[model samples]
Target chain A: MKFSRKTLGIPYGVFLTLFVVAPMIVLFYYAFTNGQGVFTLRNLTDFFTDPNTLGTLFYSLAIALTTTVVCLLIAYPVAYILATSKLKAKSVIIMIFVTPMWINFSLRITALKEILTLIEGNLAYYPFLNSVLGMTYDFLPFMILPIYNTIVKLDHSLTEAARDLGANERGAFLKVTVPLSLPGVVSGISMVFLPAMTNYVVLDMLYNSTYIMGSLIGSYFAAYNWHGGSMIALVLLGIICVFTLLTDSGEDDARTGGALL
Target chain B: MKKFRRILVPVLVLLFLYVPILMLALYSFTDSTQIGAIRSFTFKNYETLFTTDELRSMIVGTLLLALGSAVLATLLGTLGAVGAFYSKKRTSSIMSTVNQIPVINADVVTGFSLCILLVVVFGIPKDTYIPLVIGHVTLCAPFVYLSVIPKLKQMDPALYEAALDLGAKPRTALMKVVIPQILSGMVTGFMLAITLSLDDYFIATYTKPATFDTISTYVVNATKGSQTDIKTALWALSTLIFVLVIVLVLVMNLNSKKREQKEAKA
Candidate 1:
């Protein structure tokens, strides 16, 4: 039997529609409807009006932003070193960065928690710091990989040209290397920021606090308050969609040039 | 001094990365069940992990779910890539854009949305295993799709035409010409799907039925209420996985190096 390559996508198309598009619609439907299945904006409005809910959203954003910034600062130098180094086994070095992820994620966090508890013994009391450290630890690899990809692809002559034109080494690095690697920086930021906001597992394990948006949504769902959960999730989806568009619209070509891994 | 700084930076970063892991590895052999205190060293936790039914099942469940979803995702994604390769520009573009949603979308939203779809719209019983599988597939297929498409694009388009011109059937041409060219990408996609599925806690927790427990969910739940000691066993598991990953990475690097040397000589 001959299979038409054109028709090959039909099954995935159907699957995508049923599983991907339809589920998002279900979330929206639940977001708009109350327990009685009647149309109401109460869930959305109540979420916005409630200080605690608003607080969690803001806190989540703040924590995720901090994590992204910290990851960038730490990863940029390491990635720069990896990319520009004359090492023959650089891919092996990159693999070392990625290998940590092969261990179970939550278990890694659990281990980190144990180490922190040993050192400070008060991370339980300091939720914010604990969560930030955990987030940075988990997301640092994500930041490094993309920036490393971009740096590896960067033309060395650009920096050389800058130096020839009388710019100093630091200046060339700042103006040439940093600016050219912006796409990877952007991808890394998004990779870290997006997940950091939604990862309640780290928050739960490290701080046992439900102060972040992820924990709030999780608790609502756990309590069978589907409407409330769906509403928050919808808002999160909207925020992320807008965020992605803002970050990616201008950098599409440059990013596709760099390997995402 | 310059060379020292270069080596020192990498050394420090690697140490930062591994110290906690090393601590966990050390504690994995400890006889203590308490979370904060480590007293004696023993292999009891490792032994307990093998004997414990719940722990053993969690490991098996996580692996099977990852493997199963990786296989399904790779198959569907390969088909989708080929289909999109041949599709009209507008349709392919739309599919590609839609594909990015799962990659960038927050796991919570994706998980919650799927949960709503399964429990609310379809009225699928919550305890059934089907939703977990479906949810994992949805999570994984996009990664495979993304990885495979580049490989498909990189292929010489005329290879397919030549196969067809030689009087081969479309399926024969695809299996012989197209599949081999994209096999590396498919393998990469399969591995990616497995890793993504393996590390997934949010989606698994949301969609998994009451009867099933993945390693992620099991680990999280283990620490939830009163069972902190179960963590020592989890430490043993992490150490085992970490060591295995190191070995795997080394083997892969060696294989690639050998292949590269052979190609150079050839």
Candidate 2:
């Protein structure tokens, strides 16, 4: 039907105002108002000075980068397989991988914790490794689905063109399909990297609050260190906000990173 | 010979993904008080898990929370998506980003922020389902929105045109035309929302206490502090989860095959 824009505009505005703008305003209020609205930068300043907090910051970046690289290595091969193989039950393979997506994240983390604890009851060695692996497993479906979607959308005719012009299989596949799917890679990387960097609970549960970003903030909250927690929150949010903004700018064609959200 | 590479690719990929998960599934069966006791298999853990009321309730509670959060989030998110579908570019961007923030923002940050906001700012009671549901809905909304938008975008405007041309009212056109086109998006979104709510122990911890011990929380506690029986109980739970996941995968695959066949017919 021929509806006017006003019909949709008001409802949409109310949704955004309540959910998006209002919460952020509350966030900023809590960030600045240390029990009495003096509007100070104390939280931001304290975040930089604290060594333990800073250490966790470094750990988060290191873990996120490592997680992204490992996920790429693992997911690339899988995407390549789903792209190339003419298997009749390719949908079955997709279902198998996506099945993990359906399993509760907490359960998966708990399961990983079980296996790791079984392997080494002690903490100090590889909880970080386990955490990284857990994040990878949890987010792998996110990584694979987008890249696979890109591959499916790719023009196989390019490979035919490359092969006709005398390039070998490796050269054709790489030179053709891989480069063209960079948009998917961009989408996939941001998709995996953002949450992986931010998520610390998997580490917390598995490593018993080993002080990654997720756990660090969690610990502060548990301790009622609202100022300290918000301090860390500001820093983490600052690091991620640029990413949030980049993605917010409507990179619609770049990647559908919301494969499973 | 080159086709060998194509054949081998899938096998290798499957091994990479499944090997660790399989190892996890296996360890769920073997005894774990000897923590890494790989050889000894027993049904003792299963007996204990099945017998425990706390464990059973945690399972049920977690499922209920997951189902509630997913369903509610999808409902709201679907509303937001439909609303956004008719909004201007700028407004839609803001809404989608807002929808997205919960998913991308760190669980800790969101959890911490939400707890403070709910208790300190909004003056809500501490550790209630209200807070937990709000926190989860914030996270789950984007997932639903994300899943729905692509299908919504891909949907042909022609159907809406036809419905309207047939003199259907706006609501009727949406119900008859737009809704059917994006139903898969809604389904996928629902599935994703449920999955996320299930995985979320972090926010739940901040908002809800041990009174809300989920499977993840239960498993976490079970692993610590020289607790052999608890650990055995955890192993049983893990095996159950693994088997359940395998069955789910099979069902999903079958569903997808049917969809593909129906699409082929269409």
Using TM-score as the measure, which candidate wins? 1
The prediction achieving the highest DockQ against the true structure is 1
Score each candidate by Cα lDDT. 0.84, 0.71
Model 2 regions more than 4 Å off: A1-16, A110-123, A126-131, A168-170, A205-210, A244-261, B1-16, B27-42, B88-90, B154-173
Model 1 CA lDDT for position A160: 100
Clashes of 1: 0
Which pairs of residues clash in candidate 1, taking residues 3 or more apart in a chain or in different chains? none
* Model 1: per-residue Cα lDDT over A12-49, one tens digit each: 88778888899888888899999999999999899999
Over the true interface residues, superposed, what is the Cα RMSD of model 1?
2.1
Docking class of 2: acceptable
- What DockQ would candidate 1 receive versus the native complex? 0.66
| Residue lDDT tens for model 2, B44-125 | 7777787878878888988998899888877777777877877788878877766666666777677777777776677777
